[model samples]
Target: MAMVTFVDETTSGERRDALGLDIAEERLALRELIRRRVLEEAPDGDDTDRAYDRAVEAFGRNGFLVLVGDRQIEELDELVDLGPRTEVVFLRLVPLVGG
Candidate 1:
C-alpha cells in the first residue's frame, strides 16, 4: 500500500516559507509526485500497479478520492503552529477478499 499525506491549510505563503513549497502549486504537484512514486514503486505492470496509476492520476486530475482524505479544521492549527513535527499520511485502499 501507499500512503501520501498533506496538511490542508490556507497559508500558501506560510507553506512556501516553512517548507520551501508553494501550496498553491502543491495540489497538482503533489498528485503528480504521488503518481510518479507509485509508478516507481510498482513498475512491473501488474493490476496493483495499474490501479495505483489510475488512483494517483485521478488524485492529480480530480483532487479527491475515497482513499484520500482532506480536512480543514481550525483546531489542527496548533499542530502546524508547533512546527514540522506535524505530518499527514496517505495510504492505498484495497478491498478485502475472504475473511
Candidate 2:
C-alpha cells in the first residue's frame, strides 16, 4: 500500500493540509479516487452519498482540479498511477474580480 497525502489549495494561493489516505493499489481510476476522498470526508454516514454526488457535480462543473504529483487529472474515468509517497493536491480555481 502507498501513503498518499492530500492538500486543498486555491488559485489565490491559499493552501491547507487534508486527510491522507492509504491506497492498496498503485493505480486507480479518477472516479474511484474521488469516491475515496468523499468517503474520507464523510465516512459511513447518510451524508456520504450526498457528499459524493455533490463532488461529482462539482467535478463536472470544474469546481476543482485534481493534481497528482506534477500531472493534472482531467477525466473521471482516467486511470492514475500513484507512488509510495505521492502528494495529491485538489486545486480550487477562483474567478477573477470584475473580469
Candidate number of the best lDDT: 2
Tens-digit lDDT track of model 2 for 1-99: 888888999988999989889999999988888889888878455688788889888888999999998899999999989889888888997877884
Every model: Cα RMSD to truth = 12.8, 1.5
What lDDT score belongs to each candidate, Candidate 1 first? Answer: 0.37, 0.88
lDDT of 2 at 47: 84
After superposition, candidate 1 runs with Cα above 4 Å error: 1-28, 47-49, 57-88, 91-99
lDDT of 2 at 3: 83
Query: For residue 38, what is the lDDT in candidate 2?
Result: 83
How good is model 1 by TM-score? Answer: 0.28
* Residues 22-73 of candidate 1: C-alpha lDDT, one tens digit per residue: 2223233344544444554554756665766676565445333222235322
TM-score of each: 0.28, 0.90
Range of the 10 consecutive residues with the lowest summed lDDT in candidate 2: 41-50
